[model samples]
Target: MGSSARVTEPQPLPWRTTRVVLWGIGLWAVALVVTLAVPALHTGDRSWWPWCCVAGIVLGLLGYSYVRRGRGNASDA
Candidate 1:
């Protein structure tokens, strides 16, 4: 007998989506703070890390707003 091949689709829930975004925001916030406090962490390069922090904060806020606006969108599906 041949084994049956089951076709399964993974579900993406609203909480999970929100959690992922929040985690990203949290990580970026931490990195930004660390980079600001510890200049040596950038290996004497002032340009890249600081800019990354700014970008991270901006993108994190954008993602947070998107997540807030899209609450329950996944569960409705």
Candidate 2:
């Protein structure tokens, strides 16, 4: 490595994996309930709420894994 090469150290993350997982689970559950509970949401040719719910759940899970991996790396250092 040259002198100009810079190394960046790990910084603290603001959120936790558990929080993210919980949010994902909650969002998914709520969306599932809404989709299943109300007949209107399930009806029609197109729907957005269900997709949004899926997005939330996926993103939350992704966030959780990302944070967990980051934390592991930080701890190793």
Candidate 3:
């Protein structure tokens, strides 16, 4: 409520975000395979699990591309 409010610049991430996204996508893929290969995992209550993994992969790809294009705070340095 005062004019003394200070806005600090965002600090850049110290690690590679694209790599992190790829790792997450890889883990999701592994989970998807596990859910498919294990009969009990994809049954009634959990049938939507595989689709979640697929979504993760799709979103991760989008994020990876965005970071690769220098659109995010992730530094390629």
lDDT of each: 0.77, 0.73, 0.84
lDDT for model 2 = 0.73
TM-score of each: 0.67, 0.52, 0.73
Note the residue pairs that clash in candidate 2.
none
Root-mean-square deviation (CA) per prediction: 3.4, 6.0, 3.7
Q: Write the per-residue lDDT of candidate 1 for residues 28-54, one digit (tens) a residue.
A: 889888987886866665758967977
Over the stretch 1-77, how does candidate 2's per-residue lDDT look in tens digits?
A: 45797779877778765775777779797987888688788668646767777788787777677776676345667
For TM-score, candidate 2 versus 3, the one ahead is 3
lDDT of 3 by residue, 21-71 (tens): 889889988988998999898889988988988898898888888877888
Q: How many residue pairs clash in each candidate?
A: 0, 0, 0
40 in model 1: Cα distance from truth in Å?
1.2
Q: Would you list the clashing residue pairs of candidate 1? A: none
State the lDDT at 37 in candidate 2: 80
Candidates sorted by lDDT, best first = 3, 1, 2
Off-target runs (Cα >4 Å) in candidate 3 are 1-14, 74-77
Best by TM-score: 3
Local error of candidate 2 at 20, Å?
4.7
